[model samples]
Target: MKAIHIDRFVSNVTDLKPSTIPNPFSKSSQDIHIKITHAAVTHVDLLYAQGLHQNNRRHVQPPFILGTEYAGVVTHSPPSSSFPPGTRVFGGGLGAYAEQICVSEPTIRRVPSQWTNAEACAVGASGAVSYGALISVAQLKAGETVVVLGASGGLGVVAVQIAKAVGARVIAVVGGKEKAEVVRGVGADEVVDYRQEGWEARVKALGNGGEGVDVVYDGIGAVESGIRCLRYRGRLVVVGFAARGGKMENLKVNKILLKGVAVFGYRFGEDSRRDPQRTKDVWDGFMNLVEDGKIRPVIYKEDYWGLEAVSRALEDVRERKAWGRAVIRVCEVEEDTTEQKARL
Candidate 1:
């Protein structure tokens, strides 16, 4: 089977190459085999390729596949498994940039018939992360005000829409005019260009009575600014550190203490691993929003057509040329359009 193999970490994503690696091996009987048809390109993929991601620094060595999330068809399953062979599913796992993957049955979810391969693949863990941060962890409420950092990225777009879907006013903070436009199209009530000076003041002014926002979803590691944007007893959920180049940021505990705010570090993968059932509930509820057209995975417009384009796709994300989720069509398949048009 063909895959983007990382035999050893390199300094540049361009140095990675495709290899005909052996078929994936299943670790247990509960693991089902999938034939990957589409996969999403993410900043994590870029970091992982260059050995800059935390997993790389701590434990994950090379001689592994490069991608993290995918949509595919089940080719083999254990007896009486709910996901029988031929079921269409989308999920996250290592080695997703390959022709095939083997993951635990509990980890996969059935793809909605109305969803396109691109959208399904693009979803990856963004929905789960947004759901966990906004709904589960932060307990964001309707009629509240929330500020979403990195609002144009895949996960941030989902967070913006989820906040709107729950009847919250969203102040989306992005780096430029293009990203600001992207967030607005997804239902942001207000867009703040962080590249502009005084953006923090602007966000605070838009919040309740010019006090501060009810919640801050900080996926970009702008911890200090996020705390400043929060209202009294506001919730700040730290999702990622993409803007910090994957490096964790130091927070001012005095700011948090003075504001009487609650700070949370949300790791969707770790949370899911620790509490699988609760994670499934969150994911299932999030999918209900997608099925009802309340939320959709925001996919980048450019078409990356094959596995060979994986490097180019990563570069596109790294360059911020593809604002939303960038996906690669590993293998083409006819999509069902019977229910409704795909929310691309």
Candidate 2:
């Protein structure tokens, strides 16, 4: 199997590339063998490559494969498995940037029939976290207003879409006009350019009765500003610190206290690890949204082809050049001829 092999953590993405490794296969009844067709490129991948991600560094040393989420076709599975051979599946696990992966059945889910491999892979971990934050953790409801920080980025874009899917009016906070347009195209009712002064005020004005929003989905660690944009008793879900270069924010509790808002720290992967059934339930809800045509993966416009483009994909994401989720198309979709022709 060919994979983005990391022999050691390096500061530069150029040091990373694909290398041939032993193919992973189903070793037990619990395992499923998959032929990966596409995978997501994420900031966490870059962080892991640079040895900057604390949790990954603590558990996984060098000489491992890169990537966390992938969409692939099942080639082998035990008879007891729900995902039999030929099932189209997408999920998160280590070592996704490879031609093949072997994971336990519990970690994967069937890809919606309407989604292509590229689309499924593009949603991957970002979609999961976004859904978990907005629906599960924040308890966002229809008719409420929510502000999505860093709304043009991978995770933020998904958050914006999910908020809208649940009938919430979306105020997307981006850094530029182009990104504002990008989020608007994805169903955001309002767009606030964070580069502009008083952007938080602008976001607040878009809320109900020009007061404040019902929820603030914070992926950028703009703690004080996010609190400012929230209504009294609003919910704030912290998903990441992307805009601050992955640094944890020192939040002032005065605003949280004075505003009477609820602050929830959303760690989707950790929560999933702690309660697998909850993760399954989240996926079930996400799938319902997918089936209803209320949500879709927003793939970055650039096409990254094959394992050779892995380095380039990593570089693009690191430079903040991708508007949505950047994905590596590992291979052409190998659906049955009838379905392929129908899709064409």
Candidate 3:
């Protein structure tokens, strides 16, 4: 089996290399062996490479497998699990950028027939976060106005479509004109170029006559200038800090007091770990929406880079060149003998 491993803390993109190792899951305690079909490269992967996410890497050692999102077929399953062997599923795991993976039953979810491998891979991390933010954190309601910052990136794109699917009027704040168009295409009612002058004011203008939005889903953090855009009694859900090196601006305590606004900081992984049932419910609801055609995963591109291309894929996501999700085709699974013979 082949996989990509980080030799050391990579300061730049060129530092990554490919290596050959034994198949990761062949010796695992779990019953299922997943032939990893697709693995999505994410900004989080880059952060890990640069040592920016050191706190997160504390438990995991070096020469570690880096990807978190994957979709593939199950070659085996424990009797206690609901999924049978040969089932197609998508889910998040600790290390996914390899030829094969062995995941515990609890972390996997069956992929619907209507979804392609690329779409399922794209939804792995971003979709779950968006669902948690909207359904659990904000408790969003129909017809409310929602603002999504960094609306062109992987997670933001999913958030925009999900908000619209829930009947919210969405205002998207993107980095440039090109990204604004991308956000608009994803069903945001209005798009603002946050790089332009007066972009914050423009967001207010689109709101209830310079008042503000009902909910602000800010993933970009500092770059979007989030604090100034909230309405009286508005809810701000902080999802990520994509804008690196930016300062966390102080919020005016009096403003919160006068406006009755609330700020909620969220980390989806923590929520999933603390309340597994809620996380499962969120995924189930999102799956239903995908089946109903109310929300579709926006896949930017697929990079079929055998196992060696993992470094380049991670760099592409880090530099912000990859728009939605950048997926790597890992390995192919052989058809189950019983199923194949039955078809004949």
Candidate 4:
């Protein structure tokens, strides 16, 4: 089978190439087999490829497959598994960028007919990360004010929508005017440019006076003013550290202590490993929202076809040129509005 291969760590996207590998599953194996049709390129792809991510249970040393999100049709499944042959499904697994993937049946979720390939792929893990942090972890409540840092990236875009869907007023913090616009288009009540000197203060003012926002969803993982942008007892959920070369910032323990605030670090990979049932529940809930039109994956509408186009797609996401979730179409895209937002 053909799959994406990383020769070594601390490398560039140019180093990523397609390579032939042995098929890990057979017709009677317990694992489910899927022929990937769409894959989402995430910022973590760049971080891990460059040898920078902090949390790695297996201590990935490269010379391995690279990818996490995939959506396609099931080719084989045991009768005990509800996902039958030719079933349309999407989920997260290591080395997901390949043409074929073998994973446990629990890792795959049946894709609803109304969802497009891009939407199904986004729901695999990235969108669930947002839902888990906001709904499951943070316990975000309706009518509360929250701020989403990096509110225009892949995870950030989903965070903004999830917060709004739950009836919370969102103060989206982005890096520039263009990102600000993207946040607003997705239902953010206010957009604050992080580049501005007083962005944190902007977040505070929009909250309930000097108290600040009720929750701070910092996917950027910077203690860079995000710690001070929270209300008294407001929760700070560390979603990720995509900025600063994937290295965590030096956070002030005093801030958490003195502010009487709560700090939590969230990792989707770790959560999936420790709690598969919770992972399924989160994915199912996120997919339900997508089906009901309460939320949709805002995809970066760019033509990415064949495995050969993978590098360009990764580069587009790494360079932040694509606005929303970056997806690679392995087959022909069938519809609009279901997966991707209209490109202007």
Candidate 5:
């Protein structure tokens, strides 16, 4: 099977190569064999390719497939599982950029019939994290005011919609006017461009003259910008540090203490492992939201550049040039013979 492997860490995007390695699942347990239809490229994938996230213990070495989200149909599974063959599903956790993947059953979720493959692929990891963060971690309540920083990126878009669905008034912060518009379209009650002068003041002005928001979901650790916008006793959930070179160095403890606010570091993977049932519940709720049309996943672009474009996709995400989620169509799946499948 074809796959994109990071043979070495390099500053340039062209360093990645597409190679034809043996299909990964051929030697694994026959209980799972997923034909990868759509694999979404994330900023994390880019950091892994450049070896930046390696130092932070986020990624392992090269010669590894570099993706974490995907949507595809099941081509094979053990008969003991409830999911039958040819099930349309979306699963994400580890590597997903190859033509085929072998995943544990717990990692997969059945896609709603109403959702297209593109929509499912776009929602893959981001939707799950958004659900866990807004609904579970923050415990956001109806009629409360919330601020979503980095409100135009993949996870940001999902977070905005999920917050709105939970009945919160959303204040979105983006990098530019175009992104602000995107945030607004996704149901953010107000939009602010962080690049503009006095953007925090504008955010303050929106919250009834000088009052601040009840909750702040900050994906971008833009230091003082996030701290300045929060109301006293407000909860700030740190989902990621996308804006500050994927690092949070400038945050001041004094500001947090002075505000008497509660801050929580949200790592979805850890949360999922600790509370698997809760994670499954969140995924089910998200699927219901999709079925009811309360939320929609925004997919900016789809590229089937075979395996060769993986590096370019990673760079696009890292540069923030690709808006929303950028997905790569990996391979198509066909039905296996009933007799052959039964043996598994």
Candidate 6:
């Protein structure tokens, strides 16, 4: 087994490296063993690696495996569980970058039969968050207009596609032409390059009846500007602050009230235990969109292969040179042991 861990916060991407890890398994009968094949890299992962995220109230130290989401094949599980042995699954698990890890059965979801390993690893985290913001928090209705800030990044790509899948017109906000192209390719109805002059004017001009969009799916810490992009009684779904160094800042309450809109802070996976039905709704919506071919995660594969390339993935995010959400190819998908035994 192999995995990546860091000793301390450092800006150098090359400092994180893969090291040998012993095989880990479930301590109880309810846990399932996963042979990880791919791990998704996010901007939050980069911030934590750099020791810049202030949310670590736990004083989470280093010399720890760095990922929380992964996709893999199940090698061991109790027979009575929903997912038996040999199930292919994707979801959250501690120390997820490792070659093998354990997770409780409820936390993982079955990977769609037609999806690839890389897609599964990337979708579970970002897809759910996007669905929760658009469908749950904002209650976005069909044929409405949505403005997705940071439309080329991980969450932004999903937000754009999800809004489109639900029959909403999507206006994606990116920094440049490169990001605009990517956002458009992912089903955004329109692309607004914030780098250009009067970009907000472009956003405000797209509304049908109101002054601006029906909802703003903001992941870029642009709460101030995103509120202005929303129409009357519209919603601003706050997902992240990657655009502002992962910090949560002040919001203009006056603007929010003046527009007669709502602002909801969405931490999608955080409320799963307390609101299981809501979590299911979001996950089901994402799966439905995926099954219907209306949405699919765009995987970034620049200089990425095996666990060693995790650093390169993070570096790409830091430099803003990556294609989309970075996926580390952890290992080859395991062959069917039953078929192998028959051949033997």
Best candidate (score: lDDT):
1
lDDT (Cα, tens digit) per residue for candidate 5, span 44-70? 677776777633364377667777788
TM-score of each: 0.94, 0.94, 0.90, 0.90, 0.90, 0.92
The sequence of per-residue lDDT tens digits that candidate 3 reaches over residues 114-135 is: 7766678877868878878876
Global CA lDDT of candidate 2, please?
0.85
Assess the local accuracy of residue 197 in candidate 1 as a C-alpha lDDT between 0 and 100: 92
* lDDT by residue for model 1 (1-344), tens: 99998988878776666789899998997889998889999878888888887778665678789899999888899997899887788988788889899999877888877786578888778888898899999999999999999899989999999999989999999988888888989999999999889999999999999999999999889989998899889999988888887567777689989999999988887787798887888898798888889877788898888798898888888888888799998976545333322332
lDDT of 4 by residue, 1-344 (tens): 77787777746786677788887566456788877888888887776676676644365666767887888877778888888876788887677778888888777787767676677776457778999888888888998898998889989998999889889999998887777888889999999887888778878988986678899888887654776788888888888876766455887689888888888877887887799788778877776777777776777878888777778888887887877777887755344333332210
Q: How close is candidate 1 to the true structure, as a TM-score?
A: 0.94
Model 5 misplaced stretches (Cα beyond 4 Å): 26-30, 54-59, 302-304, 332-344
How high is the CA lDDT of each candidate model? 0.86, 0.85, 0.75, 0.79, 0.76, 0.80
Worst 10 residues of 1 by lDDT: 335-344
- Over 4 Å off, model 2: 333-336, 340-344
How many steric overlaps are in each model, in order?
A: 0, 0, 0, 0, 0, 0
Return the lDDT, model 1, position 137: 90
Give stretches of model 1 more than 4 Å off: 57-59, 334-344
